[model samples]
Target: MGIKSFQGPRQKQTVEEIPLRVSDYMTKKLITFYSDQTIEEVISALIKHRISGGPVVNDKYELIGMISEGDCVKHISESRYHNSPMQDMRVKDRMIANVETIDGNMNIFDAANKFLSAKRRRFPIVENGRLVGQISQMDILKATIKLKSQNW
Candidate 1:
């Protein structure tokens, strides 16, 4: 007798295609700070918005740097030591001038790798030399969840 074939014809699996582009997940509406703004203002904004940091831009809305809670904390510590006032500190003085940006069209997986290698919380997306949006670790997690059914 011929060997019994237990398994039937394989059925194709269907997966809904999801766009994994960075732009799709990046935050378009952002609370940005001005270089001339006072640290006190930035601190208040951070607290009110429940955000750790934000991007700094110029009059033309060009991304110049980033100001974070760490920067504000450092300034506060230094001000206490120097007996200086916090109001005197400006965003430009404490912001990170060398900002790293990503392209909007980049794949989400590639962006995740970048976050791991850069040790960054978020990456700003720039287009035509203008600040467009920002993608964070949270965004990557969201994407992973959405793509779980697929290759993941």
Candidate 2:
């Protein structure tokens, strides 16, 4: 029974497939830090990775906090005028607790917005309440830049 309206046939919705989500964009090889580590160690890790920051996890690989180069440098700046030795200072003394973390399965948009909003450059990707990987701002930029090449 054709009840003909004036409009022609509709086209099928073309969904631009975004294959790679945050997990695909994140750095699966994570180098995590412990809360007990000193600021010296944290700076070393940051330098080695060439990353601005990284996730601080417990022994069980739970995301606890984040350590950034800025955080370490802040102490350095403050201590420069004083006799306070930054070497003995631990990450627990400078690292920001209650940091925001994202799950590996989250979308790239979510991660990017977080980066724009926060004063951090790194984020830890957790799964099932356990640390699975780390996501840097670079990862998001790389993935989003090459969305077509994403294997998803």
Q: For residues 40-146, could you state the per-residue lDDT of candidate 2 as single tens digits?
A: 88888888887787888898988888887888889898888787888778888887888777777778887788789985677777778888888888888788778
Q: Write the per-residue lDDT of candidate 1 for residues 75-147, one digit (tens) a residue.
A: 9999999999889989989999999999999999999999999999989888877899999999999988988
lDDT of each: 0.92, 0.80
Worst 10 residues of 2 by lDDT: 143-152
lDDT of 2 at 83: 70
Location of the lowest summed lDDT over 10 successive residues in candidate 1: 143-152
- In candidate 2 the C-alpha lDDT for residue 4 amounts to 72
Query: What is the clash tally of candidate 1?
Result: 0
Q: Which portions of model 1 show Cα errors greater than 4 Å?
A: 1-16
lDDT at 1 for candidate 1? 81
